[model samples]
Every structure is written in C-alpha cells, then in structure tokens.
Target: MMTNTQTSSSTERIAAEAPLIERLRAGDDGAFAELVSTHTGRMLVVARRVTGSEADAEDAVQEAFISAFKNIEQFDGRSTLGTWLHRIVVNAALMKRRRKRSRPETSIEQLLPQFDDGFHREKPQSIEVVTNGGGGSIVEREAVMAALDELPDEFREVIVLRDVEGLDSKSAAESLGISDSLVRQRLHRGRQALMKLLERRMKGIES
Candidate 1:
C-alpha cells in the first residue's frame, strides 16, 4: 500500500515523464535509451521472481524492451513508462514460463492448512511466513522465495504479481488475463501454501 507521500511522489514522477513521453512518441533515440537505463533493473527483478530463472529473466527483459520500442506509438501514457514496461516484462516472462516448461506440478492440497476437529497438534494458522506476531525470528525473504518456487504455477504467478512485486489485484488480473476474483482466490491459496512450506522448512532447520 502506498502512503499519501508515496502517491504524491509517484504522481509527480509521472508528470515529470510527460515531456519524455512526447520525445518517445516522436521516436527520439535518447529518450528510449533513458527509459531503458531507468527501468531495466527493476524489470529484471520482477521477471526473475516470476520465472525463477536468471537466463529466462534476462531474455524476457530484452524482449520486452524491444517490444516496447516497437510499440511506443501505441503507448497511451495513462501509465508511467515504468509501469508500462513492468507489465510488458511480466507478460514476457510468463510467456517464457509457458514455453520453457513441460513438467507436471505437485498438487498443493496437501500443503494447505489442515483441518482440526477441536483437536490437532498445532494449527497452521499460527504460522506466519513473512513475520510472526509472536516476535520469532522473521522468515528470511530468500526462504520465502524458495517456498514460492515450490507452488504450482497457477498459484505462483498471482502471488508474484500481487504480493511479491506489489501490483494490485486488478493489475495482476489484467497482467495474467484472469478475473479479479480468480486472482484473489489464487493469492489466498498461494499464501497459505507458502506459509505451510516455510513452516515445515523452519521446523526442519530447528530440528
């Protein structure tokens, strides 16, 4: 979530990019180079988190940059150039994921929170994958990333877009070509599965 200050700053940044937008629309080489220099690092991070492969992430970012340049005339400027490029890189990475993999994914049903009939050794809800309210050692982000990679693709993509990369549910749905409700459902289950995986890993570490 963005604070008022962050929202104001984002608005100012977009406003500042307006002149560069004009230059981009007019096919200025320097403006396009500036856009690349500005956004590539973040784009690579987003791509890598989704695809879970450094090579794939680099390929997706390169493809996205080339596509953005070719499609600059069609860019409407409703989103800042970075936001537009982010969306493009996400789509590009998702495409490569589809094209690069042909393996069966494990079902996540077993990893979901277990049921208790007023009795169980422990409740899964008590576990916090990101931070525990009990002030336990916070789960490392590298651990969380590893857990995310174990999720089935259907669950992983929504989590990456909405939670890890900070795109809103609506934007995540738009990027993944799914409905908002579907995004919510997947994010919900993805988070639960992630927590369960991290909980198991933490127990192993302690043991």
Candidate 2:
C-alpha cells in the first residue's frame, strides 16, 4: 500500500513532468502551448515568490522560457521540463536579485537566513482566526495574499513552491538546488512562519 506521503509524492512527480515530456519530446506545437498554459501561472507565482516583485517575476519567467527553449536539447528525459524550467526561472530571478543587490551587499545578508535552524516554526495564528470568523467579512482574499507578502521572501518562496505550486519536496528541492531534506525543513518552517504571521495580524486586529 502506498503511504499517503508516497502517493502524494508520486502524483506530483508525475504531474509535474508528464506534459513537458510528451509535448517537447514529440515536437508537438500544441504541446508547447499546452505546456505554457499548464505552467505559466504557477511559474509566475514561483518567480514572484523568489523575486518578491511582480515585475522581476515577469522578467524571470520570460527569461526562463527563453533559456528553456535554448536548452531543450540538453534536456534528458530523466527529469520533467517543468522542473528544468523552474530551475532556470529561479536562477534568473536570483540573478536579477543579485543585480539589484549589487549596490548594497547588505541586502543579500538581510535576505538569506543566518542559520538552518527552524527558527520560524509555527504558522501564523491567522488561519485559526480566519477559520473561526475572526476577520468575519472584513479580510478579503486579497488580504491573505498581502499577508503572504509580509513573510520573509525565503519563507514565502518555500511555502508557495510546496503548498501553492504543489511541487513535491524532491522537485522543489531540485528547483531550488537544495537537498530534499532541506526542502522539507523549509516547507515546515515556512508554514509555521506564515501561521505565526497570520496569528499576529489577527490579534492586532481584534485589539
């Protein structure tokens, strides 16, 4: 019997790679369009999570596609094209951020976490509040998005990749060029951080 975790991991792995494998390998034009349609939104979301700016995310995604097309020949069927494209996008986004940080090296230090410890472990309390009608009708869906904006970029990126983009730990780790264990740790810590942020925001509102 497949454990729930194994089933989820298998399902995500299959979903993430199957389309690119089919369309790109077969040289099907419609497959390319299908690929774009299937991944563009989530790619943008991941890009935005990494770059922390929609404009940068847009640029990163465009550049990633360009890179992916150029590198398609290098793609072995060993991994999905979506995974390949995601790595390209992340590199592009990181390069853009590095360019932006050129003037102030301090920003790099500020952005990256100092330690691997899961310092931010608990999720924002807002989820409970939101579930319990704490905000009632006042907080719109956009507010939740904005709350995500409040998280540190790294935390947001891991969470968005794992929870929002629906990437498994392996693919997410591969995309980020990190270990799978690290991806799992980040995802756990990221969820905790977001939950903590939400809780704090909710308390502030009620007070």
Candidate 3:
C-alpha cells in the first residue's frame, strides 16, 4: 500500500507531466526525444532484469518505447508516465522471454531453507538479502544484481518486482498473473535464496 505522502507525490508528478503527455499524444518529436532520454536507462535496467541479456533488453526497451508512443493517447492520468512506461517495458521483456528459448533454470527449492518434522530448520543459518542498501557502493549494487540473476526466472521476477522495483504485492501479482499469496510466498523464498547467494559471493570475495 502506498503511504499518503507517496500518493501525494505521485499525484503531483502526474499533474506536472500533463503537458508533456499532451505533447506526446500530439506526436511532437522533441517531446518524444525528451521522454526517451529521461527514461531509457531506467527502462533498460528493468528490461535487463527481465530478459537477462543486454541485446534482448535493449530490444525490449525499444519495443516498449514504440508501443508507448503509439498508445500515448490511451494513457489515463491514474499513474505517472514513467510508471506506465515501466510497465510497458516489463511487458515487452516478458514477451521477448517467451519468444526465446530460455536456459535451464536452477531449482529455487534447493536454495530455500529446509525444515524437519518439528518445523525447525534442518540446517539453520541466518539469511539476510539487503533490499534497501545503506551503503550505496557500486560493488554492493553489482553484488546484489549478481545474486538476483542467479535465481530461477519465477523467483527472480518476483523479487525484482517486489524488492527491487518497489511494487506492492497486489501490483506485482497483477503484473505476473499470479495470486497475492503466491507473490508473498515467492518473495519470501526468493529473498532467502538471494541472501544465501550474496553471502557466498561476499565470502568468495574475502577469500
């Protein structure tokens, strides 16, 4: 759920973007350039996460921008333009993934914490996947991305949408065509798997 302040800020941003959206709908080339320049990098990041390759991600972002341009008039003021574009990019990436044959994925169940008959972890270990980084270091960011990339597609998608992209459970569920309960379950298991991967990476780096 969005806080009052977040809702107000989003509303203000949408209001501010009204003129730009109008220009886009009017097919103003300069306005389109501005939109592309402002959002391409962020959109590429989302695409890369979803498609898992630079070339495919770039294609996905390009397709998303073209689609967004074609449908600019249909965009209601319910969400900011950036948010709308983000959704388009994600959809494009998902479509690209469906078109391409994906590599074999690792089983997330192997990474999840196992429990015995008493509901106790058979081999308990602390798993902490830092979603919000206190240290904004490039190395830390890369580490997080690396760990995220190791997860299976389903698990990775859930974590990226919820933890990295800041989507609520309901929103993520809607985006992925999954239930709210499944989103929560995937998020929990994904974070645990990610934490284990990150810890191993950090230890390897230290060694």
TM-score leader: 1
Tens-digit lDDT track for model 3 on 10-107? 87888999999888888899999999999999899889988878999999999999999888889997888878888899889988976884666667
lDDT of 2 by residue, 109-136 (tens): 2333334486744332335645466555
Clashing pairs in 1: none
Candidate achieving higher TM-score, 2 or 3: 3
**TM-score list, all predictions:** 0.82, 0.62, 0.78
Off by over 4 Å in 2: 1-38, 97-127, 134-143, 205-207
* Model 2 TM-score, 2 decimals: 0.62
Q: What lDDT is reached at residue 2 by model 1?
A: 20
Could you give the C-alpha RMSD of every candidate to the true structure, in order shown?
4.0, 7.0, 4.7
Query: Candidate 1, overall lDDT?
Result: 0.81
Model-by-model lDDT, in order? Answer: 0.81, 0.66, 0.81
Ranking by TM-score: 1, 3, 2
Ranking by lDDT: 3, 1, 2
Model with the higher lDDT, candidate 2 or 3: 3
Ten-residue stretch with the least lDDT total in model 2 = 104-113
Our tally of clashes for model 1 stands at 0
